[model samples]
Target: MKELKHLNKYFKKYWFKLLIGVLITIIARIFSLIMPSYVNKSIQAVEEFMADTISLSEAKGMLLQYILVIVGAALLSALFTFLMRQTIINVSRYIEYDLKNEVFDHYQLLSLNFYKKNRIGDLMNRISEDINQVRMYAGPAIMYGIQTLTLFVCLVPLMFIKAPTLAAYTLLPLPILSVLIYQISKVIHKRSTKVQEFLSTLSTFTQESFSGISVIKAYGIEPRINAELRVLANQGKDTSMSLAKVNAWFFPLMILLIGISNIFVVYIGGRQYINGDIESIGVIAEFILYVNMLTWPVAIVGWLTSIIQTAEASQKRINEFLKAEPSIKNEVLQPTVIHGDIEFKNVTFTYEDTDITALKDISFKVKAGQTVAILGKTGSGKSTILDLVARLYDVTSGEVLIDGVPVQKLNLNSLRNSIGAVPQDAFLFSDTIENNIRFGNENASHDEIVAVAKKAVVHKNIEGFAKKYDTILGERGITLSGGQKQRVSIARALLKNPQIYLFDDCLSAVDTETEEEILNNLKKVSESKTTLIVSHRVSSAKNADKIIVLDNGKIIQEGSHQELNAVDGYYKELYLNQLSGKE
Candidate 1:
């Protein structure tokens, strides 16, 4: 219940709708109460007729009136019960939507470090499975809790007013029932939390397996995957069954206690009637109906508690992420203009998770319209330089500046929107080729998409397909070849037409001839944009205005390509090696 307090704002938002539902539940219960009173009256009428206190015709008339009133009251009760669902359940759905959106929005605001700390499937579980449990508390549990309280408040006083002694006997088992439910509810809460945790584990395993299905098949490891799934499935089933076993105790216990209550009513009432303490048998019948009326609300007590405990556990998980502060905060809300004059002065960065320093006293600058090529061996910090400029990872010690202003001081959205980056992996979405390209520019026309595709030298390849740009790609653009995916990703960035361009080995997948053509096209489009090219090939850097060579997270060589070619350095040796290979 403490964890569930997180949803108080949502409760306040829909308080009016819940208030209406409460009034309806009360009115419906009152209407339902009319029947028992009428049942007593109808029985009394028969007794009067048997004792000859009234004419048979008059008794028949009274019975008919009572029957009509009873039926009308029952119908009114049924109608209001329907309205109760419309109000309370619908509010639950509204709250669910708001909660899901809130979690998702928070997820987007979190930094890359947070994603590194968490799993995709676990994140997905919190938004979907965890929120669903909380919704049950918002809707059905609250509705039934109100109904139960209403019955107890309205029914208890009337039961005593009718027959205090009988009421006393009938409610004797309730205290014991309450104590049992409290003990059982504690167990239920513990088990519920375990079930939720296991579900998340199962989800993560399934998602990872599906994403790596190709790798598993390539290695002929289907049996190994199946064995791992079996282990996860067994654990999941055991947790779920443990929860079910405890839940199984609730309904049977309720029924048994209710049956004891029924026994008390009949046995006590009969004794009273026989001992002349009661006026008529009709009183006995009315008390029986009263006890019966209490049966459902009482039985639902255990169920309502179960739902509440489960919701509390789930909401606790949801609250954990909601309370997390993003590592990177937006210092400026108002938009700031970006001209792409990027600079990093005395920058150093260490990966927090692995504690590996990706950059060591790194420093570089690119003017508003200059092409810089960074050449390095794998793990030599070339990508880290581009990442620092893009502000993906903040520098551990030093400054990242754009147009002489600190990068952190600038508006995050404005800065990101100004830069177009094609990542090392060239990721794309599972959507139409046109839609994937349009992700960079949502309002881009079909002609603009085609134009960028041609600039990236992928237009003819796309046009060769039957659907051209309309072809649907599989997850992560799996439907396309590695080279085609890289080309499409390049086209997406070109479509953004940002002030700063980052090509992170985007040409590695394509052949040398195609890479040359794409580079020629990029040179045209990036004429006045600050562009950083990270690559292993000497050809990619041979024509740049400046070439930087890095080794082990430190810049070892920096000069023009021709200048470096003349010097005795790694750059010269690499150029000669590639040139000899070309011959």
Candidate 2:
């Protein structure tokens, strides 16, 4: 219910449409209920003829009128059913669209830490399966629910009027049915949640296996991977079977209750007629018709309850996602544009659940139009510093300032929009090469795309493809080599033409010769914008205007290439080791 309440934003927009739909549904159900009265009238007319109160021809005429009334009611019921589906069910679709869009929008606002902790498959499940479950509640569940409720509202009093004692006896099983539904609904909710969770696990496994299929093939471990996949699939199947078992037990009990109620009506009404307490067979026929009318609507309770419970579970998951507070929130006032003057004032950052700080009391400043290279070993804080600059993560202590304003206080979109970042692992969608390069700037011309590709030293390789820029890539751009992916990512960043640029070991996959060539081409691109490069190779950092050497999360040296090369420290040691390896 809380999850449904959270959807009030969408409800507000479509409430009027839903109101009109409900009215139509109620009118339709009323027409259907009135047809049972026609049955009563027809029987009454026949009874009158048998008692010599009416001629056979007159009774036949009355029966004919009731037959036409039944036909009209049936036709009107079908028409409103169509109208309600068009209105309410269509509204559910619109709301689903709105809900999915909002969830995606909120996901974009969340900090990188959130993605680091959450799986892509789990998020995908919430978007797809969970949202669809919510839609069922909105559409078919609510539609039938209203129809069933309307029948009770219209038919119950009429059932009493036809024969109060019979009505009371027939309804005797309902309170027990209510209790059974309440208890079974709890089990359904719990089992449905487990099934959904297992489904998400299966989704995660499938996504991971497909994404890593190349590695599995290269390692010749398909059997091992398949075995692992089977484990997850089996778990998913077992949970689903468990849910089905509960449903299996509940449905029969529901059918039994319906049968028991009907049995009571027939027995009690038959006895009353024989004992001469009732008027005639026509009255008993009307009472039986009313009970039959009540049957399906009451039976539908089991189905509607299941839908509602599933929705409740799905909504709980969706609400957890929606209610998650983004670690980063942009609440700054009139934040000035970033001119790429970045500073870290004794910044310290420790990742969640880690005792040691990733970046310890780090302080540095890069002026506009400067290229600063950070050189470090495997676990050094080079990438952490760049992460702070992009505000992918805020500093755990101290401050990061861009153009004199605190990075935290700056507008998030404006801040991120100002920077272009290329990470070590280049990820691209399955799309045309042209589209991948144009991802940073969708409005970029073909000429502009080719220009950036050439600058990143990837144009020649792209031209070698069968369709050149139009060549479609596989998942994660896996059709391309590692070096090609890196070059494409670099070209994507180059196309952005941002105020600041960050390259975190993006040249690692390329050969040193190709790396040098790409670096030489980027000299012009790096001239006016602030640029930060995190690399382990001396070739990548040797020509930088400034170099910062880091070790164990602390800056060990800071100077130009020659200045650091002349020093007797970690930088000098790294230079000597690489130079000797070359010789």
Instruction: Please report, in order, the local distance difference test score of every candidate based on alpha carbons.
Output: 0.90, 0.87
For each candidate in turn, the TM-score is 0.97, 0.93
* Cα RMSD, each candidate: 1.5, 2.3
User: In lDDT terms, which candidate is top?
Assistant: 1
- What would you estimate as the lDDT of candidate 2? 0.87
Tell me the deviation in Å of residue 56 in model 2.
Answer: 4.9
Q: For candidate 2, lDDT tens digit of each residue in 241-274?
A: 8888887777677778877887887789889889
Instruction: Score residue 321 of candidate 1 by CA lDDT.
Output: 97
Residue 104 of model 1 has an lDDT of: 98
